[model samples]
Target chain A: MIEPFTVLSSRTVVLPVDNIDTDQIIPARFLTTTQRDGLGRHLFADWRRDAANRPREDFVLNRPGAEGARILVAGRNFGCGSSREHAPWALLDYGFRAVISTEIADIFRSNALRNGLLPVVIDADSHAWLLAHPGAEIGIDLRDCTVRMAAGREAGFEVEPFARHCLLNGIDPLGWLLSQVPAIQAYEDRAACRA
Target chain B: MTAPRTLFRKVWDRHVVVPETAATPAVLYIDLHLVHEVTSPQAFAALRERGLKVRRPDRTLATVDHSVPTAEASWASGLGEMDHAARYQVRTLGENCGRSGVRLFGVNSARRGIVHVIGPEQGATQPGMTIVCGDSHTTTHGAFGALAFGIGTTEVGHVLATQCLLQRLPRTLLVELEGRLGPGVTAKDVILGVIGRIGVDGGTGHVIEFRGEAVSAMSMEERMTLCNMAIEAGARAGMVAPDETTFEYLAGRPMAPQGEAWERAVVEWRELNSDPGAEYDRSVTIDVGALEPQVTWGTDPGMVMPVSGRIPAPAGAGHRKALDYMGLSAGAAIAGQPVQVVFIGSCTNSRLSDLRAAAAVLRGRRVAPGVRAMIVPGSQQVRAAAEAEGLDRVFRDAGAEWHQSGCSLCIAMNGDRAAAGQYVVSTSNRNFEGRQGQGARTLLASPLTAAASAITGKVADPRPLLEEGRRIA
Candidate 1:
């Protein structure tokens, strides 16, 4: 369901680490299953591992404060490697609606939005500010592409007009293509005639 | 304003099957289809699902790479019962191609090498042809003056179903290089310099045509290395107009037609250059003589500077964040960053040429202790060729692991990965965060730098190690 009004949850899980790759987001072991269910339990499956290769409780995501986090506050260049759609798929499946980072990888940024996850860029000071105010909530209005954080702090970020429009309309690129069925049909007819 | 004759316009006009309109996608005529292990599975699956055949299957060539277990799994016994991701992908490629009557150059096949390397070596890549692959580094094929681009699975399906697809014409930029490169500076430095000047997104929607005196003088392999990283600057594709060098490289390959056909092909290829009055949307120029060997300090291809230059202080939010996360400080020379691992293999640089370059460095040197070094050949054919020349033995004797061919450290989609916080000097295309593995730091460089780093156990210039005997065979 597309919610008319959305707010970034205050319960943020900070991964203040750089170069968090797609495989680490969802390990290859969990990828064998085709479906999207129960992926949340396996998020950060490899990094959260103990010396015995079991889930490490000391990992941030396993901590009580970060359980069921919907907004992931990550370090710089988050989602930098791989073109696997599974990375965003797993992140979305695990209930993360927004990812706040200093820099997002080029493909990963586009992939996240297409998969219905929002990627936000905040300056280092803002990032530190958010980390300091752990329970600070930010209200994200997709229509305006603006984030309103606690204590009256607000920032204007940009999303591609097409992507913003698509997210608001709950239309994937393929779905957007289908919406232009009339134009597509006409083009096909003209192409056939030319042939 | 004088009418700008852009590289994109010239190439686009040459290949345009139908005129452009707001409603219709540009009808691009494809000349070759190069496939590899990582991206072909889904395309083949789409073909099977549609109950369609690969249109112009002869134009389509397949080679195995990516997901190759180049380490311990180089032997078949090592792959037993592992159900490794690459093993499945390799098997799928073989089975799918066999069923479809498309050629699958398997690891067992002598011709199998990195797709880009094998394509050019066999002369499948030629001028004025459009090439597409599922993998991004397909730009490597552009060195032959063919338009090339990476496509998604759906686009792959579209190509498989019809042997053609609708595409938007890209804006063209003429990136002119001036002056001779300094000694120790190579083609890698040239492209890395271009990327540094033009940020990653600078070429976002354009096709880059490299020109000028310096570029025209490069060898085919060097040209491929430059074009391969076009995607790094966010270009749709890149091309170098075909010339004598291009013609020479294709002369004896098996796929290239001989006799009158070869003559005719060359005649046609000579016309692939941009017309004098062609128009371009934009242009950028670089003076290569001033550039030094480059190394990346931050998480992006754009976050690179000359090895002699210090890491820049974070300027934008993105830059600051990238530096902080990489645990780097401003003004620190990138040359001496202690590398935890060194990887030299990928579609970008895993050819016989790349191997020869690395081998020249590894000939008498020992890898620094506590530093893991691996050299995965781009293809099985490349592996054999290296072994034939004792390059593999050189690597092994120098304390580096000689691996079977595959896209080993490029994306690490298979089991091969670096542990968290591990810093890797890699020859792969992108050094984006976690590209090698989760929390794994990647420093992008040419194979020479990767091998040199492997030997010295830190980021070091490869020039000294390679000066005497490392002319690319």
Candidate 2:
């Protein structure tokens, strides 16, 4: 079940790499499990671990001051490969409430949104600003569709109103769609009558 | 007045269940939904949690591909290693499909194979249809003039509960291929050339319509190979307008319409092409005749060049990083680069024709010493067809491991993987870092290219081998 999301403010981690694909977010080897739990432990497993399976201290997630970061500021073309929802599942499991990137892939964006993970698209300047200032607290107001940086700057973003409604209500779109089945049937009936 | 309609617009407009309003995106009805083991388990769980069943079970198909081992032992037992997580995932899919009254092509089933390959083989994928799958390569169905794209696991759950997807219409891009493809240059080479020219994110936010003589000349399977990697170009989907080739391929398949139904379907499909004066948001043309067999030199599919070309100098940070990871130097020739492993499989190029092309090169030759080569058919049906013609024996005699069908060594989720630090020439789609295995470098190529490389143990061109064979004959 997805939690209702409205406003979130938290310290953000900066991952300044472009085209961070779903495979990097969650490797295919770790995808054998059906359950979504415990995936955060394997997030970026290849980059986070050495060949001997030791944790690499140089990686950003392993660095100090990166703990409990609820927002991720990433590079362009984020989530660029595969249609695996494991990418967003791992992010949400890792305690990230939102992701800020210059661009997001089509399937990844929809997946993240449906899973209650906010995918915020901002201008390159704002992205650079957020990356330059590490551990900065960023604010996301989904109700207003704007992201506020720690430096007192604001950028507007867009989300389909229906997705927004679903997110705000903490409801799956499937239920709403089921409710509209009668209307859909009526439309089909009218088309058949016309034919 | 409205604008003239492209092929994408024609198909999409016809499938819209509800037009877009201020509050929501259009609810587009899905004609087919292909499910695989890797992404459908959680979707089934989600459905169970809500006490819901699949809305249209007949329109949905399930297969165990991504997490299934390609070894013959596993095929016989319908199981891999006893304690592996992949076994549980594959088993869970069978249970879910059985419980939901949805059909599944399990390991024991002769029709079982990769979702993308089996769909068209069964005649389930057709022109003017909207298809969705939890795997990105679902774009493979677009070759039949269908509007197919990948969806996330959450969206998979939604689609299971409702046979509709709420989607914003994607803009259309026209990719016109001019001239005829030269001999020995296959559709894999054509797509690789396009990705190299356009870069990785070139087609983002657009549905690409591949038009002109070259695409029209391609066989249905060849067109599928072209469309299978559209996601590598960041396109929402790739499509080729339906023609006589499309009709001929679907005529006798099991799920295809028969007799009068088939005739009526062909007439409607013929009208599915873009209007002559239709305008796309963006257009680009490539002379395919001028191209050669292409290979990826870096992590991404976009870092590709013709086999006769030299490695490019690093132009950006990404290029430098890709070069560093791939253990390649700037300005080096891609040819003569030694490869330790050669894989001829994956949805990209594992069809019957692909196997034939590879077999043609390996019939009288042997794999180079110290090279590990394997040939995995895309599906059980493909495997059966290849064996009926002794293609399997040809591969095995040439020192290649001919294995059962599934997605093997493509992503290396199963036991199949390249050794660390090994360079692999593969016929799979992606060559991203550690895509074949941890710390393994991969070069994406056609089956013919992979076959030639297996013989020489390097990035060797297949043209010389083809010419030599023709002269000998």
- Choose the strongest candidate by lDDT: 2
Q: Which stretches of candidate 2 lie over 4 Å from their true place?
A: A184-195, B1-3, B76-83
Assess each model's interface with DockQ, reporting 2 decimals per model.
Answer: 0.11, 0.70
Clashing pairs in 1: A48-A56, B4-B279, B4-B280, B5-B278, B5-B279, B5-B280, B6-B279, B6-B280, B66-B407
lDDT of 2 by residue, B375-402 (tens): 9999999999999999999998999999
Question: Tens digits of per-residue lDDT for model 2 on A1-195?
Answer: 469999998999998888888888998998999997878888888888988999899898999988999999898888887989999989989889899989988888989999899989888888889889888988899999998976579988888789899998898887777776766666556645733
Provide the overall lDDT of each model, using Cα atoms, as 2-decimal numbers: 0.74, 0.90
**Evaluated on chain B only, what are the TM-scores of all the candidate structures, in order?**
0.93, 0.98
Interface RMSD of each: 5.9, 1.3
Question: In candidate 1, which residue ranges exceed 4 Å CA deviation?
Answer: A1-195, B1-7, B14-18, B76-78, B466-473
Candidate with maximal TM-score: 2
Question: For model 2, what is the error of residue B420's alpha carbon versus the real structure, in angstroms, after optimal superposition?
Answer: 1.3
- List model 1 lDDT by residue over B1-473, tens digit each: 64644545555665555555654455565668877766567667756755777766776889876655566654657556444656777788888778877777886777877787788877888777788876667888889888887764555656666666556666788899998987767788789889889877677667899999889988888899999988777777889998999899889788887988889788877877777877667888888987778888887787888776788888776678678658788988888889999999887788888889888888888999999998988777678788999998899999998887776777775567888788899988777656677678888888888888998888998877677545543
Interface RMSD of 2: 1.3
For every model in order, the fraction of real contacts preserved is: 0.01, 0.68
